[model samples]
Target: MNTSDEVRTFTVAPDDDGVRLDRWFKRHLPQIGFGTVSKWARTGQIRVDGKRAKPDDRLVAGQQLRVPPGGDAPHKKPREKPALSEAEISQAKDMVITETESAIVLNKPPGLATQGGTGTKTHVDGLLDAFAPGEDEPRPRLVHRLDKDTSGVLLIARTPGSAAHFSKRFSGRSAKKVYWALVVGVPEVHEGVIEAPLAKQPGSGGEKMHVDHEGGQPAKTKYRVVEKAGQKAAWLELEPMTGRTHQLRVHCAAMGNPIVGDGKYGGKDAFLTGSISRKMHLHARRLIIGSPEGGKLDVTAELPEHFAASMEQLGFDIGLSNAEPIRDDPPPKSREEKKQAARLHAKQYRKSRKGERRGRRDATTAKPKPKPKPKAKR
Candidate 1:
């Protein structure tokens, strides 16, 4: 209903600091589509502090955003979400393990995706409307994701600001997540690190991942064997040092000990015989991350029914293993950071060499001592 031809200017609020320019539009101007925003940005119609801005450009607090008018013009309505049924509402509430003012930790069950995709209908994101506080308030946001078939502790941010906060923790590698998995065989080394690069498989239409050493993104995982079922199976605790798509699954498969029931990577060898369920035996056991409200949020999810049954059948004692989070290895520096560090090191080296050269020059230029006049020919 904004009919004024004049442009509108908004001051970026503190809560929205560091958000992407397009995201700001989505948050503040829901009526405007991403295509429209991108077009406006391309045409230099949108300005941040009197400078043309890109959609992905990060906005700082107190910056003036100049938006051209006509964004509120009538357009095709967005598809409305179908109303949730009673059963769907119950299912969403049932998954909540812990709820704070800023986050909701869910013990997500296997087979439910974190977000929707082609052929994925009953995903966790669709149910998030159940958690919306009110008509005007923003719905909860997914800060992180789990595989459709890999379930465990999934965190949901209650607000956009908190979503950004949690996302930073995850991207910075400060968040600790522990996964429990049952692999086909005990690893030769009881505990070790798996460092492998991964890439999308060539012919799978990006539905699968493979270990691509020569040309792939760096990925690392630290694994410790909790207990073994006489070499037939082993319950392993896995910590991913890098967040790569299907990193853990690919790494474990590459280690020659594919996780039990993961047929995609391991194929026939991934399965176990005699009473083990075919369901993937990987569960996100625990998550520890900084909460928006100051302290840390540490929560553990109980093993899924199939996983628990398999462990019991294998006679593995859950109490025998420690669940403490391993200290995360520092994330690799970005290209810019690496360049900055190299420049600093070179500068220091040059400065030190300069000091040494100056000392040598001073010593060489100083007049030679008389050598105490040869001690008066003593």
Candidate 2:
């Protein structure tokens, strides 16, 4: 074994298909033991692309894998990014729910982008491309996408046919989509539908969708307020009837209650600042889609830390059993914040005024004609 040599990690490209992790290392580095590879998978040594590669982790024709910096690295410098901690990369790898000959399912975490975009080098799609099995092997391709800030079930198709089939279902609205959002206030109407339109803002080559009435695509969403936030915020369960880019975001915004931590659409309480990011409050909670082979497929994703953090900071009671929010007044208010407070305060004032008006009208209608009886008697 070359003890002092450094090894360069290779993403699972087509040329490296059908190779076992242990076998790949043996070929690449003479006599590294199978036990050593296994230990590395357990520890933080060998990784796939930027993740830890298990000994038995089947090498797809193309997947990204890393050979550790120690032990027989290339003579010249290897052009790879700083290798990921075996733990962080492996954590994502472990979230794959199902994998078949034709596709793979992953519950993507919040904060991880689905594919490479501007200023994003490491993403799920690029890693899949690098780790794919062969030139002839079908690459793992995205059928749909979740927001970089939203965590949820994501589907990948291994074949072109599979990709097309899944795409059709999403386009036709045959996919069952469910989402959970932490928003700023309990709505007056608990269960109602929000129908609105979405327009794409194409200025910075980013996927930012806005609410537009005229030149926008049509969209609709139905929501039931799951839990109220003591007039401050609410936890909502949403079912989108149509699939438009950022449909939920725009609809919520149009309803005058943008989600917490959603800075783009004018969310107040949970806007992104230095510590909080824009993606904290929304999650793709669950998905049910038809499998390429046969029956129904369902997957769920756990709430990522950012969403949880918002919950912690806001103290919104999200309908959990026996969960208690701090029993104190809300934080000190600013002048603008006070104005918004007045708007909510007007709700109670208006309700009392309306009651008083109704009472006066009822009294007027109930007056008797005693004067006519007295005149008849006289």
Candidate 3:
């Protein structure tokens, strides 16, 4: 290990452009642990362009990154990935809905984990080796995630640069993801926004979430009822405005119409009595996002078997939702724009108050009382 006593500064490369500050360290300075990087950021030791920066802050090309030196090591070779079997490679390729130079859109099926965990041996990440490029190129990376039970459009970045690009779009909430789900009941309102704050439910080992308005992260979902099956269930087009863990599930339950087959959030009520499949009905139907190569990368995934069967059983028309992309609501006002609006409102209020005062003064000064004398003669 070689330690450095002097500070070091490096310019962000174009390839590293939209990556998080911490991820940059992982790529370029593997010797440093995430905890150390976080501590440095918290204490103001790490600076980007002369300003204190957070570990999650996105880095731009040509930005100067100041690093305080202590942990430095000679370059270590990356660990070789285990060779995947032919079966695994076939499984991975079978899931691809569309592929581009920078991305691979997978129509992920239900019950398959995106990445591995305890007892999770088969996963999309494990099979990513099938898509590996040349020996010098990095393996495809996951830009976003979907629940193991909720299936549909999953984007995989083909390179580190594209990974960084896609990750930034997701974190900035610029990417639009549309979901299709069968909920237990129809919402009284056909279309509206569900704005609720969510927090992890207690005692579920952080495996569950609930609406916790008082102390929770802000979450919003815009839902439209595409069709209904009498009073039994409704097919909904859901667009989550803010991404949160299990956001769509929680919001649907919050509206008193839990998604079909999501027993974790809705319990027994989540399932229907008939031929409806007992699998979670949430499917990520479409994704529209900017590509690294310039134009938008819009892809739609076909519905999984269970969801499709349920739709047919419920007499729903697939054509009801043409899957035409809906326009996103305008972005929130910037700080300067909000300040300008406040100033304009204040000016208008002051002007109205002045007009009221002038009216009062004019009424008081009017030669008005000649009026009552003529009424007595009449």
Q: Rate the local accuracy (lDDT) of all candidates.
A: 0.88, 0.69, 0.89
Residue lDDT tens for model 3, 197-289: 999999999989999989999999988888999889999999998989999999999999999999998999999997789999999999999
Give the per-residue lDDT digits (tens) of candidate 2, residues 1-378: 334546565656443466677766764554455776777788977777677767877677557676655544335342234345566556647768777655687878877888887799767776564435354454568989987877777888876556766787888878887788887767665666887788887693556887778988888888866666477778787778888877888788778778877777754554634554466588777777786677877766677777777666666554452211112233455576577668778987998799899999999999676664454654
- The CA lDDT at 2 in model 2 is 36
Q: RMSD, each candidate, Å?
A: 15.6, 17.4, 13.3
lDDT per residue as tens, model 1, 2-65: 4447889999976688899989988877777799899999999999999999999999989999
Q: How large an RMSD does model 3 have?
A: 13.3
- TM-scores of the models, in the given order? 0.72, 0.58, 0.71
- The top-ranked prediction according to TM-score is 1
Return the lDDT, model 3, position 237. Answer: 90
The list of candidate 2 runs beyond 4 A from truth reads 1-92, 134-136, 201-207, 267-269, 272-279, 309-378
Which residue pairs overlap in candidate 3's backbone? none
Those runs of model 1 whose alpha carbons end farther than 4 Å from true positions after fitting are: 1-25, 32-71, 74-81, 327-378
Q: What overall lDDT, based on C-alpha atoms, would model 1 receive against the true structure?
A: 0.88
TM-score attained by model 3: 0.71
